[model samples]
Target: MKVFDKYILKSFLEPFLATFFVVLFVLVMQSLWLAFDEIAGKGIDIFFILKFLVYLALMLTPTALPIGILLSSIMALGNLSENYEMAAIKSAGISLKRVIRPLIFLILFISALNFVFLNNIYPWATLKQKNLYLNMKKKKPALALVPGAFNTDIPGYSIKFEEKYGEEDNLLKNVQIADLSQSKGKIKVITAQKGIISTEEGSKYMTLTLENGNYYEEHINKSMQPKDRAKMPASKATFKTYTINIDISSFNDDDKLDDEKIKEHHGMLSIVQLDSISKVNKIKYDEYTKNQADYFFNILEAKKLYKYPDSLIDTKLDSVILNNFTTYNKSIVLNESIQLLKRTIDHNKNQKISFKDKRKLLNLYDHEIYYRISFSLACLVLFFIGAPLGSIIRKGGFGLPMIMAIIIFVIYFFISKLGGNLSEESAISALFGSWLSTLILLPFGILLTRRATQGMGIFNIDSVLDNIQKLFNKTGNKTTNL
Candidate 1:
């Protein structure tokens, strides 16, 4: 029995490793291609390049694990079926169920690993990836600009250098900078024959190492026509060692996260934790709670605007309806104080409304907040579906199962993305939006595996089509007989 278990385990390991490698390669290759120009052109080191790919691979592993399992399981089982190994075991009085037990245990172990990944490692990796992007964005453009090229990405500036040296890091000769930094927004064209980039206080600034550099700058709001502005333009400064601060733009808006925990809290926290923080820390929960609250507020707000009585003079009717709306809306939303701020912004945008009324409406948005927590936990739900599915759909190899896994996983990914968005905008219940993809795919996987194990055949899309054809033929024959 131990030998049988070992054999079963061995049957899966080869395919499992193969699928994992393929998936990792696919992920790293895609990201490397996307970042190729930046890495190669910008003189980025291999260490940084490797770190970027590693973070990306980590983020993608959870997304790819299910597909790996599906493909690997299919390859392993299909190989077994092709060799008549299953038949032999059956002849020896061993059920297919018993033969597959060790393999299922292996899958269970993998599922546990996936659970840890989804909850902890994945979130950390993705967050790191975001931060990396942010740091790149805030880094100096001059450092990234290729010598002898028209570099225009810098803020309110442009540069072109005559030469580059040291392969990656060297000074530029005959450098020209179009600096538009005056009250009149004039352009200062500075030409330096020789210059070197130096780093000080953790910031990069260009230091003109030689004299003989002509300087042209534009003054802001100069009383001159277009041609006159060019000739008699703004204040231009020239110096041999004019050290200027490198333009460092702030991080990208999405990446400028103040709270790492909030961004990552999605894949963490149990239902009880969700309820606990949501219940206790009304103020502290605002960062994460906003999404769920949006769900409830959206629904309640819809009810208020669209659910008005048909008759305008129906004061009694309006009074009761408005009261109901107010009550329900207030129950689920964040602090009503934020409502006052909303009303102010709305009023400024030519939208006249009562702060009292708007705040009352906005008070009911908490339902949407809790919905995201529900969605994050559904990763476990997907694992359950992915497992038995791969087992039942034992095809020739990874080819068929891989396709199926991609289709299913993409659908799952898309549905959650859509639901999470709609939930934020109040198009669906928070719980429903978060759990929508899982719920939809759960029954589908269940139905598919259920049919497979019941002698209906695994992934028998062929038999299904064949049966439909036969049924049509039968109906045609019956009509002819009639």
Candidate 2:
């Protein structure tokens, strides 16, 4: 029995590691392509880029784990069944369940490790990755400039270039700039046949030296007088060389903003921190509901405090009182009632908005908490599904197993994402939304496992089609008799 367990585990480990790294690499490359726009041509440090890649890989671990486990389990068990090892074990009086017992224990351990990653490592990686990306954006503002596009990184200025060259990217050809710093109604345009850009170390300014350029300054409606504006002529100058200096010191500052100032993003908090936040948000939500209820009660009491006879307070307005009251008195009463109702409406509207915001925050915390558990358990759920499905299929190797794993995972991913969106919108309770995918996968895993143990294939298209045809023939015979 010990030797059998070891052999089964060994088979699982080989494909498990291979599938994990392959899936991880593919996911990382996908993420890199998505972020290429932000990182390319940015002149960012190589070390920073490496950090970005590492954190991104870490973030993708949870997403990759379930699929890897599913593929590996399917391949391992299918290989054993294909080679007739499983048949030998069953013939020797060992049940299929008994054969899988050792692997189940191993899967449970991996599930626990996945939870550790989610609770500690995942959150840390999420935080560092976000902050580092923001720092990179700040450190390389010049990367925003692309040839043939109007670059607006500089305040009150827009620059365009037909072409740019050189290792330092200092040479600019056919440069055009529009300056709008001085007056809103005036325009200043500068064009150069060729230009060079330079920045001084530890300086707050960047200089643009242009050769063979023209400058145009035009003022529309000068002096705010129609006649004077028409007479005031536009100024134009042609020059062989010109220079412009702009401030860019903000890009050089290495002082990254403190994470504390951002008030701790929910995605970046650990299990302990999430628990504390959920509790706090719950208290706040309860308080908001209580205060809103009390507010309405007070408004109703205030409306009653107005001096009115019991006779005048009928559910239906009293016709006698309405007829007896003078026009002036009637007008005064109507105005007072209208003012009170308007105030009540305003208060209700404000309270509704406030309560809604608090409840949304509470829902976020709840979703996060449940998400940690559900995603962690997904590993074990997928394992049961994969191992049984492989045995039933009796197909081994990456080709067929990869397709099966991907189809199952895609369904899981789509359902989980939909549930998350619904929970975030408060359309469903956080607990239900977060656990929906796990609940769906659990029964599927159980069904597959049962079929495998019973020596029945889960998918038998030909058998199903033949059964349908037989039913149709019976229906045809009944129709003929009628």
lDDT of 1 by residue, 348-433 (tens): 45422332333322322333244434444444454445544554554557567678767766887798778776765557766677
Q: TM-scores, in order shown?
A: 0.60, 0.79
**Candidate 2 positional error at 33, Å:** 3.0
Query: Per-residue CA lDDT of candidate 2, range 363-476, in tens?
Result: 888899899899989999999999999998888999999999999999999989888889978999899999989999899999999999988888778899999999999999
RMSD, every candidate, angstroms: 10.8, 5.0
Each prediction's total of clashing residue pairs, residues at least 3 apart in sequence or on different chains, is: 23, 0
Residue pairs with backbone overlap in model 2: none
